[model samples]
Target: MLEPEHGLIRQVEHAHTKCWVCVLSCLLLASVYVGSLYVWRSSLPRDHPSVIKRRCASVLLVSALSPAAVKAWIHWADIRVDVSVWELMGVRLEGFVPALILPLLLTMVFYLGPLVHSAMDDPDGFTTELQSVLDVQSWRLCVRDVVWLRNQVVAPVTEELVFRGGMLPMLVPCAGPTAAIFVAPLFFGVAHLHHIIEQQRLQRDGMSVILLVAGMQFLYTTVFGAFTAFIFMRTGHIVGPVLCHSFCNSQGLPDIGFALQHRERTALLFSYLMGALLFLVLLFPLTDPFFYGAIPVCSLAPAPEPVC
Candidate 1:
């Protein structure tokens, strides 16, 4: 019964409402994330057991809170919350494996040259380091690294829940899938800038180094956010991005120092880089939803009627 102009106005208002919800949800989550870190750092010794427990609790609290808040907002706004956890968190083989592997493979390729050079140049040292990593005692220390815990497991779950699971669906109503994919990641990228503040507090690094490091982090995290958003949209599940994030954190970034020093290593690095590029070129086709038979990602709003 509504006229065309009235319908357009309604759509605009709906989009604006959804956008506001997404922004406010992200802001609330970011505040909790950074605030918890500051509080823990201030209250306890850096390595204290209480700090670890508190960090885990804070992450869990915020992760749980964000989704609940979103659901409540949706219901209160008279919007349907039809997205399921399975749709948000399911792990199908086709979608999950590639999602997990591609980033890891790219990371390995990035480090391939340096790793090969290290093995050849200092075989004993390399073997010793490998052995140490594999050693039970070393694993115990790794388990104790709160930062590792946060990055590998906690952050993946909570961030995916907040950003991909919560925010992206809300965004789909307002922005469509393409815009949602790109826009939600901006918040993700900004959320990570808090790392710079944390680093400055802990390290007495010169301003130049701090700024450079922070800049690179912001760039990479933003790019990775976009990538994760894409994966979430394609696979229609939070699990895809969560696994990818965890694997990425485990692999960390490649150290290319050896490639700079040796010609052979340089060639190897170039080859790996080329391979990574090829993989990226193929990423979309390989991850197509039809190929995976993934559940269709439900939108937050009903689609408009088609015109004759």
Candidate 2:
């Protein structure tokens, strides 16, 4: 078999234009995610499932739209580079399992852990507030509708294209992995800062809450972005971190500050164990070489030198 570097280089060279197109397509998809919500809000039914479906549809729409948008946009916008349908399928398909399945497993384990904690206090107030924040029927309903759409579909697609596909590749060769990981999330946080601002402005009926909700959302999303960036570096696939992130977010896990303070306690050990296990689900492929081999991602080799 030919060396992998031979294939990697050809892959990069052939797909370079499509890569840029993916990055640009993210911006368009984000607009769609936000815009569709605004345009359809009044028309959407107030029932839990309907509300959740519309929101989830928006997210899935963004995920599904990125590649198609990129293909059309690149064909018209960049005449210098050519991209084949196979390459498009390769990139998107490479993303599917990690983006979808892994997160679901992690969330299941994460919630189950808390349920086992005898001292684990249910935040009914937070739960009620969260349901209102999502404008959905129930927690389970929101999970099926909003989270499945946003994290699994929209967030992974848009975020991976911008960070791993666009920003990381541009910086990794020049600044190396450490720098790329750090820098990428800073920009990712910046990209989604508007979410924080929007959440703060949201007032549902008479339930006026403090501005902390916005701050929390910003902090949470940024933290998620940082973790996702690291996963992409470790696994050489944007899918890994995207799965890791969606899992972490959907479970409504506590922040690092709380996790650390409780790290040494035995009573709270189950929660930590569950959270750790959830994190491991995202790392499954990396830990299992056989599984890694099954996925179509860039090799973990240093970039091959250009032939003179």
Candidate 3:
């Protein structure tokens, strides 16, 4: 294959349109969703069950469903072909392995390791808090089913599209990779505060529990959010974050249940440290495109300068 004799930026300019749009959408949504979360926070009771349901629904609709629908529409209508003139062509990977896979792998290491440890520390305790408030109903099965479906399937699909697909691109131009990564997680944590508060409403002493439980949940989501953003940035694929998120969320639940059951101090500390580590890692410069790699080419590469 013929190769260009310019910086990496020159190469990316000629890449595919659909690919760029997908990446761009990820970045844009991440920022918008984060902004929306902040706006809605004060209006809702942090510990109300209805508030949690509403917040979850809002996020799901905006981040995943809407964007996916738009994508489908564009593809089906053949708008992609019409928009081809605006695309960056020739962005094929240089080798068998995607350059992004390594960075993504390392990021997973930091996110998953800590998340697992944290969940193990705070096991089934969250459940007791929920059960004590209600008459021990058979809804346990339903709750479990919903939680699994929500986290494993629904959440991953919706959240990945928003943070990684939509909002992330908006940040890349303004903040570059470093800020983009942190911003996504920060917003993710803020967004989940509603759910934590919802959990609190089920308890008698709602105010007292809200802070602790919300903080724990926030720590869990923020780390994963950052990691997912990293996946989007590196691989430029929406699926990366969804897979990582589902895997991470699935692994942590049982451990969290166990921690709640035993109420072990070691478990708590272990989980906390893991969150802290991830929090700290969020600040590090871990292979950002602008910082460490060759310049990227865009589809918008101007006509080649006439040879002087």
Candidates in order, TM-scores: namely: 0.76, 0.51, 0.47
Clash numbers, per candidate: 1, 0, 45
Runs in model 1 with CA error above 4 Å?
1-4, 41-50, 89-147, 296-298, 301-308
lDDT (10s digit) by residue, model 2, range 1-308: 67898999877775565445534444554556456554445443334456656655665555555556545654643422233422322344444554445434544455555544423455675566545766746546645665466655556665665445545444343344565556556556655555443444444423234335545656766666666665555434555555655555555655445644654446566566766776666544433323333322222113532110
lDDT of 2 at 218: 60
State how far residue 270 of model 1 sits from its true place (Å).
3.3
**Model 1 residue 11 distance off true place after TM-score fit, in angstroms:** 3.7
| Per-candidate local distance difference test | 0.67, 0.50, 0.51
Q: lDDT: which is higher, 1 or 3?
A: 1
Please, what are the lDDT tens digits per residue for candidate 3 over residues 1-308? 23545655554564344345544554455555544444455444543455446556666657545445444534532332222211111122332143334444544555553445444545575456446547556445546555555667767777766555545543344345556678757767876776554455456466757787778888978877876766555444555467667766755633444445554656555655575476456433443433323222121112321110
lDDT of 1: 0.67
Ranking by lDDT: 1, 3, 2
Which residues of candidate 2, in runs, are more than 4 Å off? 1-29, 41-51, 72-180, 183-211, 232-246, 255-265, 269-291, 294-308
TM-score of 3: 0.47
RMSD of each: 4.7, 9.6, 11.9
Worst 10 residues of 2 by lDDT: 299-308
Please give the range of 10 consecutive residues that has the lowest summed lDDT in model 1.
299-308
lDDT of prediction 2: 0.50
